[model samples]
Target: MRKTSVLIRSIFTETLELINISDVVSKSIRCDGSELIVCGRRYDLREIKHFVIVAAGKAATPMHDAVVAELERSPHVWMNVTALLISPTAPRHERANVTFFPGAHPTPNEVSREAAESTLSYLSKVDGHTFVMFLMSGGASSMLEAPIDPNISISETAEFYGALVASGLSITEMNVLRKHFSLVKGGRLAVAASRAAAQCTLIVSDVPSHSSDSVGSGPSLPDSSTVQDSISLFEGLQDRVLLPESVISFFNGPLLTETPKQTDKAFARSFHRVILSSTELAEAATRLAKASGFHVEVDSTCDEWECRDAVKYLLDRTEALARIHPRVCLISVGEVLVQVHGRSGKGGRNQHFVLSCAMELRQRHSHITVLSAGSDGIDGNSPAAGAIADWTTFERARLMGIDAQSCLDTFDSFLVFKELGDAIMTGPTGNNLRDIRILMSDHEEHAIYHEF
Candidate 1:
């Protein structure tokens, strides 16, 4: 049984390593010129007068690289191609036709605002013969904020965002609120691209259920939510959510076309949406489980979970898996939330979940190893994307003179995980599939103790 657990852990780790690579994933979403035929009309790229590419979110770099490579290979296609890539950081690449912009995630920065302005500037030059490609993924929301009012600053946006995270609001609800505040989100980019003769929007979906519009605030998809929905979410915010003065004024003031109504004609008229990736990482892990001779179950838990109860529910799931014959490996992929009561010290939601899970696992004789990671190679505002925890996590903390319970109480999981050298570091993976968690354990009789 111990041997089986070890094998399962190895398989899970191997699966994560394989599926998270840019090269492998790029193959799944590459745009070959041959696949360009649409609507019974074969649009020849060689005839295109202009070509433009816009890449955004965590997967922006790799996805941009892949499409750029594809276009470069098609010498038969003749056009002046220019690419605009927006991500949390600019990757190490040099292409004459490509412009890389580094922005901030989870909140808009000065750089992000500049990037947004630059995209709009480029959009103004597009013509009817231009073909625009929009590559979108998660985190695009913060990478580009439209700044509905000149008085709305990033600091004020951060305060509202901080309050929203603590309010236990769903991403869908949060984005609805975010769209009203932004100039570039909620299909506005698509509206900009509508000026082009042909527009192709490809997505590496990180949103739950692969909702195209919700991913990166649907810069290409027509907005289905309304301003009323945004107001309701804001008002329902558990007395902890703070609103910026500008946001409050915008919501309260009488402005025409403040939100996207379900019946809005803009959604149906423009843009061609394509979803290229999703929670398939769980499927990759499942294959590894089969290779290791364990029965694996992969479910879209991201869709079923409620944000408010996510942490406690995940803890319960991990505990239940720990009791599962000490041989089976349980893997899950999805996003969860950590409700911040006060100032959170430092950590992402996954780190907080793993730490909280570790506390409970320690009471059960501490045999399990839990790895919780954000697929984007980032978690919260930290460089380390995620963290790992096990039975001995608390024991190690005692050695470091850190109070595990106190840190957990303060929601400082990053600090606790850091002291134990358990944080997982994968810088700028250029992909976002939310979170992946693996739970591994073994029986006491056959378990081997590794000295640190």
Candidate 2:
């Protein structure tokens, strides 16, 4: 009989492989001579005079490297062709043709503001026949910002993000508000690039449904959010004093235009936005489980499912199976949101969920391995994409002088997992599928005690 814990670990491994950066990057990229294809169309670099590459989000480094490899000759690209990376560890500036800036994610910082301003400056020089390649991935919202309101600083924007995160808003909803508050978002970049030789956007989707407009707030696509929607997104947090006066003025004033109903018609003429990567990794993960000789089942749940509900469903199902056979593995995908309340701790949704699941599994000795990770290699507001936990994870914490209860109570999964050494780190995987959770049976428990 197959060990339940091994089977569960296999499932988790499969899921990670499905969304592996190499797989996603390979699938999205194709090169033929001087023509490089991103989404579908082919662009001949030889035909274009100036090539400017702009990348934002966690996937920047991979995307940048991919673009650089496609160039036939180093001289074929111009020194003016700059690369902007939102994440901290972007590609280095070895070649004069390329420039790199490390920005922030989830929240804006001084460096992010500078990067956004630099991006806008690059836009000013774009003209007809200027080849503009846009690389977008998760976390571009804050990294690609250009202040619509001059008085608003990075501090205010960061503060707003902090509050929004605490309020437990969806990425799409938060981006809707962000688009109204910035000039670079909502396809404005597309509009600018429309004046270029040809604009192509390569997106590694983090959104569950792969909505082009929602990912990175649709820098190269039409934005469907309005100011009214932004106000509503704030809800009770509207008067919380988290936002700056300039931000307040922009929100309250008439300057914040509703995002375009669709991509600018000019965008259709000048640009092509392609979704190169997404939850396909989930399918890969599914296949990996089956190939490993485990009876595998994939639940294609809607991304809109709540995290708590999803966790509950997993727990309930796992428990039921334990009651019956006690040797089943469940794999889950899609991002989950966590609403922060009072003196919260430091951890992303994946961490929080794992912490919660660990707490439940602590007493039952279910031997679960709740492995939640972002495909792009970073979870919300944290460096580690996600974490892994088994029944012993809690006990291990106790042994290490860490209290799981207090950590969860403070909503700090990062610290909890860090102490327990269960944090999953992959850097930037160049792929995104939101989060993956794998519930396993302890391998030792099945091998040593439960021989069928």
Candidate 3:
């Protein structure tokens, strides 16, 4: 058990190191005096009279710092450099030229509105000689916002988001709905930066497919979704979630506008690159597992699966793999959905996943250890990032007189794991790339080795 725990920790640490915001940004973007090179594109910085950085998301501060460091390395091209950063947390740097706005996440608030207005205000000042650099990541949809209609209050927006969260829809579906209602999402930011000489967007993708337009609702990239798609998605909720009347009306009203598309002139000078993705994290974990003398099997992206089905599928595969290989590690990446019915309790999808697996593992008396976590180090509303479970997790719950199924049904896996000391906590990891699930099994492992 100790060796297995150490191996899991090593894999997790290695994955985080590979997706470090500072390292990703520094490696993907560089400014060399006259030319600014990012993901293979080159822009002559010498001709630009002004260079502005607009960044928002979980890793906004670190990403901004990396860009600033690269810019400072080329002092000749550092003239007129300014920045506007929006994040769920406070600024990490105290740069006079960089304005920081701390916004709400998982849901938008007045601060989110303020940040959106501030960003637009800065973009409004850009001229033909300005070069704009946009940095975006997972939480941007909630951290930055500018609604197209004035009648839609922040509370209405919050209610809309709440509905989406409870709708059991994928992130892509929710983001598609989000892009239609905002003024600065779905390529609107690119439209706002149209006056700039050139624009570039660097993305740290949290979406399953690393869709450039879906990350942060694709503020600086073309949106392929339409108003009809958003309406259909909301309608498919089938009364499982409730939306504010204003929100319902907005979707039904004539005020709905399609987001900027590929044909828009705003993209003429815009270049987008997804610098980091969840697949990279999965690959990093695979490498670590192989180095530890375990046979690694990576599952395809499981973005569309519900929490229950995803856990079942991975566990079934792990069991089969363990029979053939003495040591096996199965990795799966992507966000899973959890349908919250009635009064749902505290716990995110990852915790729910781990709890569900624990139930099955205990029933089968399997000697497998599973760890599920959000790469961003935050799982839902709980303080814990996620949870770890083994064959004995259910036994521990039974001994404590805790009903595991009851917890799973009520969406209260957080409490179950907390009581068992199986919760994985790593305060906000400054980066987001979706979630990762690691399942390990050893053919000769016994009951004694299953105890954490």
Candidate 4:
């Protein structure tokens, strides 16, 4: 059992490295003296005088480093280069031309506003001789925000986010509302950059669909959502949600403007590319599982589903797969939604998912081990990445005087896993592709099967 656990952890670690930001950026973006290439689009640097780099998200620093490295290697291409990075933390590598602004995540704050203002100020200076390089990833939406209505207090915005988190809204739905209220989201940033000669956006996608318009609310791409979509989603959740009166009124009233459209002039000179996604992560895990001598099954449903239903769905699939193969490894990639009601405890969607699976495994006396974790290395409000559970997880929790069912009811899976020492902690991984789940069953092989 100990050996199996060690092998599983090793595989997960390797899977994360396969989609690291630095590697992904280095492979996708490059520059020569005459032309700068990104994801196959070429820009003539000889015609551009000034280069501006704006980056945001959890992976902002590393992504910035990668971009700067590429530009530095081709100094003849961009002689005058300036950079502005907005991230949850400071930069890992500091350079004279680069300025880093630290901001809040999962919720926007005053720092987020300052970051937006600084970016806008820099972008406002762009002219036909300038080239804009925008780097965006998962946390960009929260880290880079400037409310359209100055009257809307930051507290009101925070309250709106709090309600959305508690309401278990999908990332797509939440981003629609965010776009309607922000000055920087929904392709407005692209409009601002339109003054430049050309614009290129390199994205590390955390959203399930890998839609350029959905990732980071499409700051540098055209928005597919509209005012009507935002209003319809809000109306459906109004009764069960705790949204501010000001927010409701703002959406219900006619003071809203549509985001930039695909036909808008803003995108005429812009090129958007998704460098990394959840599908790549899942494929990497599948390859590693096969090399480790396990029959691999990959499921690519990487959307936010209800916690309980997701756990049941994975378990049923795993059980059926185990009956046919003696050594089976099921790889499921997606984010689960956990609705927090009343007084909630500390935990993220990944922790809630594994805990639910632990309870079901204990009830059925099944010998299965499951691991769920965020690719970014932070789960919800807790410091732990996520949690790991097996058939013995519930029994071990009981021995530690922790009630698994009670914890799940209050959304406190972090505490339950903490007490049992089953929490997986990787700190901030500087990457966000979504969540990865691994389920394994070896019931048929009572003896450990050797690859020899």
Best by lDDT: 3
What's the best-to-worst order under TM-score? 3, 4, 1, 2
lDDT per residue as tens, model 3, 18-133: 76778878988887657888888888876788888999998787888889888878766665888988986666668778888885789999988998888888888898889999
Q: Could you give the C-alpha RMSD of every candidate to the true structure, in order shown? A: 3.7, 3.8, 1.8, 2.8
Please write out the lDDT profile of model 2 over residues 1-452, one tens digit for every residue.
Answer: 23443455455555665554444555665656667676567777676777778888777777777666555344445443566556656564466656677757667888877887788788778877687878888788877776788777778888877777666667787788877778888888777666787777777777756566788888877776776888776555574426666776777787877766554664765554545544576667667755754344445363545667767778776666545554455566776777776776668888888888887777665655667777767776677878877666677788888998888888778998877667776776655556777665434455564221
Superior by lDDT: candidate 2 or candidate 4: 4
Please report, as a residue range, the 10-residue window in candidate 1 with the lowest summed lDDT. Answer: 30-39
- lDDT by residue for model 1 over 1-452, one digit each (tens)? 23443454455456556664356435543335644443233466555778888899888887777666656666644237888889865655787777888867777788778888888788778877787778888888888776777677878876666666667666777788777767788777766666687776777777677456788887667777777777777678736566777767766665414644335444443455444454577877777866765545554454425433554455566557656655555677877755667677877777877887778767766566777777777777566777877767887898889999898888777888777767777776766776777766555422565442
Best prediction by TM-score:
3
For candidate 2, what is the lDDT?
0.69
| Alpha-carbon lDDT, every model | 0.69, 0.69, 0.85, 0.84
Runs in model 2 deviating more than 4 A are 1-36, 43-47, 73-82, 239-241, 270-276, 300-305, 319-326, 362-367, 380-383, 392-401, 426-431, 441-452
The window of 10 residues in a row where model 2 has the poorest summed lDDT is 443-452
Each prediction's TM-score versus the true structure: 0.86, 0.86, 0.96, 0.95
Off by over 4 Å in 1: 1-13, 20-42, 76-78, 255-278, 300-326, 444-452
For model 4, where is the 10-residue window of minimal lDDT?
443-452
TM-score of 3: 0.96
Query: Candidate 1: TM-score?
Result: 0.86
